[model samples]
Target: MSPARVGRVIRRCVALLLVLGLAGCGDAAAAQTGTVTVFAAASLTESFTTLGRQFEEAHPGNRVVFNFGGSSALATQINEGAPADVFAAAAPANMATVTGAAAPVTFVRNQLVIAVTDGNPKRVTGLAGLTAPGLKVALCAESVPCGAAAATALAAAGVSLTPVTLEQDVKAALAKVRFGEVDAALVYRTDAEASAADVDGIEFPESAKAINDYPIVLLKDAANPGGGQMFIDYVLSADGVRVLTEAGFQAP
Candidate 1:
């Protein structure tokens, strides 16, 4: 073969190899990026949404999809084979219900409060105030973490009152107060604070008796376990704490 022809063949081989190497790198990068599906408590909606945005910004090509609801309902969904990458529960009891998850870690704490319409139209003052005659109230169902906390706080205060409706999640209960469907609702301080523009969060001493510890874990069958771990790490980081505290969640 001519020397010029041999040099041309060498250049073609080098270019082909470079193209193959770049293609392989692209495939690997694609494999490392996907949506991390997180099943978190309803109370975490606002803060988690904020954190999800930050996470996606920091890790280009990755996304966070959240399924927010009552912790018990979330646990049931995960235990029944729901496809989720992470589980963030409002209480450890709910977290314990899921079987296929890594060891759970308590990330934050939340307390219940009396949520009333803005300006306190009902003149609601404390847990006791919720029992006034002709008052309509809303509480979470007993199975929900917020409801369990409400029961404990009401018991601590020695107050007993029937709610007009029992909501399945903290946000639902808070919505009752926001929409004027009820006079007040016992809900997480974070939830009440998030809707402060439409509702008033009234703190009571009994809340100290029923603080709920929030726990998070990576699901064993997670489609994006690495991304789930990344999110968990971010939640435990200083930035995550700042967001949670700003939303009225206490440090774990």
Candidate 2:
């Protein structure tokens, strides 16, 4: 073979090898499977956990991981560039913290309720009863969504009572009641329902004025955008709504 012809043949082979290597890289990227991280409100622990498992079951190669905390804290983490696929917040105010997130959708609504020890051991009847002097009370901090809602309800009812402790999230407030550390705590109706076996919920007309809307959105920097969207769609589906309803969340 001529030397020039040999050189041309070698050049073509090198080019072909380069193209094949690039194609292999693309294939590897497409085949990669990763866990989807979800940041959600503390109040969503039970329902979201159940849904996360269902999501993982539906997506065989993918996993669902959750970070549940106060909605405000989760929003802050997302805004600070946390690697999260989805964010489900308990209030619109907290959702607003994350700029550039996909348009948020209101998935459910929640109302504040007074949680007391099981069997009405304290004989607490309504919001007024929580004001009794020396009655230990736990409340979410005013900065958290649940605490803000409690404040709204109290204001609307013309009732003001000092809480013995201010917690960072609804779950913490509920925990106080569950542990018998406080006589009562103001928490979401869903939270109260979740702990029904250990506590009783008291309905008050004031809760109507402080209903909270839960919003969900896909993070702009989601590592698994497709999976995140699928999870969000499932949560908005009829089956998901049924689960939320059973957990005591009102329809949005």
Candidate 3:
């Protein structure tokens, strides 16, 4: 081949190599992107949702998604092999069901409360007051972490009151108070505070027995492994603490 022809062939090979290099770089960038799914308790919905947004903004290349429900339900789902990277539970016992008390850490605390509709409906005062005759009350079912903690508090106080309805979750119980469907409902302080615009909280002495610590854990093989750690760290950070405190969670 002539010298000019040889030079032209060299230029064509150089352009092909450059195209392959750019394609490889694009593939690597795409592989690094993905969404992290978290299964958290219903009580954490507000704070976690806010925290999720903060996390997505901070980590630019990833997205954070949450599945919020009762602690028991969330734990059951995780244990059943749900595709989740993080689990933020409302109670240690519930966390134990999935994480088995090995790696979870308590990140915040909360206590039970007697929340009533606006105007202190029915003159409710304390735990003992819930047992009054003719007063409709709402409570979470025995299965949920909040319900279990509530049962412990009531038993400790020697108060036995039957709820008109056993809600599926704490928010549902609090909804009863917010809508005036029930005179009072036993719900977490955070739930009451979240619904403060619609209901009022009455702190009770017996609630001390019902205090709960929320635990968060990153799954062993998290799809978004580093994202889970970042989120957990953020929850323990200043911004996460602010959101949790504003939502009425006690400092851990």
TM-score of each: 0.88, 0.86, 0.84
Q: Give all candidate RMSDs, comma-separated.
A: 6.1, 6.0, 6.9
lDDT tens digits by residue: candidate 3, 32-122: 5568888888888888999989877876787888998999988888878788888899888888888433499899999988899888958
Ranking by lDDT: 1, 2, 3
Of the candidates shown, which would achieve the greatest TM-score relative to the real structure? 1
lDDT of every predicted structure (CA atoms): 0.93, 0.91, 0.86
Summarize candidate 2's per-residue lDDT along 19-56 as a digit string, tens digits: 99999998765554568899999999999989888867
Angstrom error of the Cα, residue 123, model 1: value is 0.8
Candidate 1 TM-score over all chains jointly: 0.88
When summed lDDT is taken over every stretch of 10 residues in candidate 3, the lowest stretch is 26-35
Pairs with backbone N, CA or C atoms under 3 Å apart (clashes), candidate 1: none
Q: After aligning candidate 3 to the native by TM-score, how far in Å is the CA of 5 from where it should be? A: 43
Per-residue lDDT value at 90 in model 3: 88
The residue pairs in collision within model 2 are none
